[model samples]
Target: MSDYKAFRVELKDKIAHVAINRPDKFNAMNADFWTEIVDIFRWVDETDEVRVVVLSGVGKHFSAGIDLGMLAAGTHKYGKDVGRNAELQRRVILKLQGSINAVDNCRKPVLAAIQGYCLGGGIDLITACDMRYATVDAQLSIREVDMGLAADIGTLQRLPRIIGDGLARELAYTARTINGEEARSIGLVNRTYADHDALQAGVLEIAQEIAGKSPIAVRGTKRMLDYMRDHSIDDGLEYIATWNAAMLQSEDLRIAMTAFMNKQKPEFAD
Candidate 1:
């Protein structure tokens, strides 16, 4: 993967390891961040060589959310003209939301490994991932409320379905920070390690395991899970049946069954 101003990307053994690289600024989202993230996920979706992705941060923190300076500059472009300002703000919000949604919409499963502070937009980023793991000392917060604005990106929408309405509402209302343990307890993160080193190692192992699977089956499963989140049980069941009708015919199925009989690992093609 080419170098990005706001991220570090490394592709290995069908797994893409992507880390927010702006450590000096706590990896804060700036102008480059919004566009680069969208580009990265779009590339992931188009690359058949990649089967899974691991997202994390470099240095001390995951992210401190949007850079206050960047936020100010972007918003300041529209003056106090109520009509034009509102329309411009709406467009910017939609663009930001679309970038975050790309992570959720990617066909490959995304696992986020968070450490240090994951606040505001950072929380929005992780909630979009398929699974989240964090360092035990990490601090997470839904901090937009503290800034006098509701989270307009995705935390308000996706987080409620993640940790339930009561807990999600409490976080949004209070803007209180939660440690990794509390995050795990609330089902925000799947697991927590003692430190950043352990967090990265643990997440990489899981990513490797997922990357080893049949890409077709893995992608199909991710698609179904996303679909089921919005539909009823009956609808989900019918959708999966129709999905399998086409996907079950893949050569990977034969490779897997034959591997089982021979007690060998299955080698699947993209």
Candidate 2:
């Protein structure tokens, strides 16, 4: 894998740990962040060795969101023509959305380990993950309204589904910050730890547990859950029926069954 300017990626055992590396800048998302994340997640998607991903940040905060300097510089390039400027801006927003979608659409499940500040674009990033765990003191916010724009990335779309529309709307409109305890109460995060160390340990334990499962089964479960979001219950049932008809034939199933009968741990092939 290539060196990443915005992230530090390490694969150990079957888990891929992707950490935002810009601690000095509060792990702010710059131009490199937008492009490099897509590259990283793409690698994760294609690599059979990688069974799951744990996304976090180096240093005290998860991320303070997009770099203000980069945001301002992007706007400075707009031309005098109103129509052209709007079109250019629209493309930029779409590209940003695609970056977040990389995490959302990755075949393997992603678990976010959040601490400190998770605001603005950070909110977008974590919302895209399959599960989230945070430090009890982690400060999270839907901060786009304060910046004079709607969150154009995944937060506005995904947050509502995770936390429910009423609370999501309140957060977006108020641009208020909530601690991890409140986040857990509202189902924004699955669990909360007392500190960052405990948070990392807890999330890693979960990731390792998931990595021990059959990769094919885990991927298929994620696929089904994502499909269920935009589909009817009947559609989900039919889709999974069609899906398992083929997947049920994998050797992993036989191995799992045999292991169960013998009271042994099943080790699945990648």
Task: Give each model a TM-score.
Answer: 0.98, 0.99
Q: What is the Å distance of residue 149 in model 1 from its true position? A: 0.7
- Model 2 TM-score, 2 decimals: 0.99
lDDT tens digits by residue: candidate 1, 33-148:
99999999999999999999999999999999998998888766878789999899899999999999999999999999999999999999999999999988999999998899
Instruction: Give the Cα-based TM-score of candidate 1 against the true structure.
Output: 0.98
Best by TM-score: 2
- RMSD, every candidate, angstroms: 0.9, 0.6
Tell me model 1's lDDT, rounded to 2 decimals: 0.94
What's the residue-level lDDT of 55 in candidate 2? 100
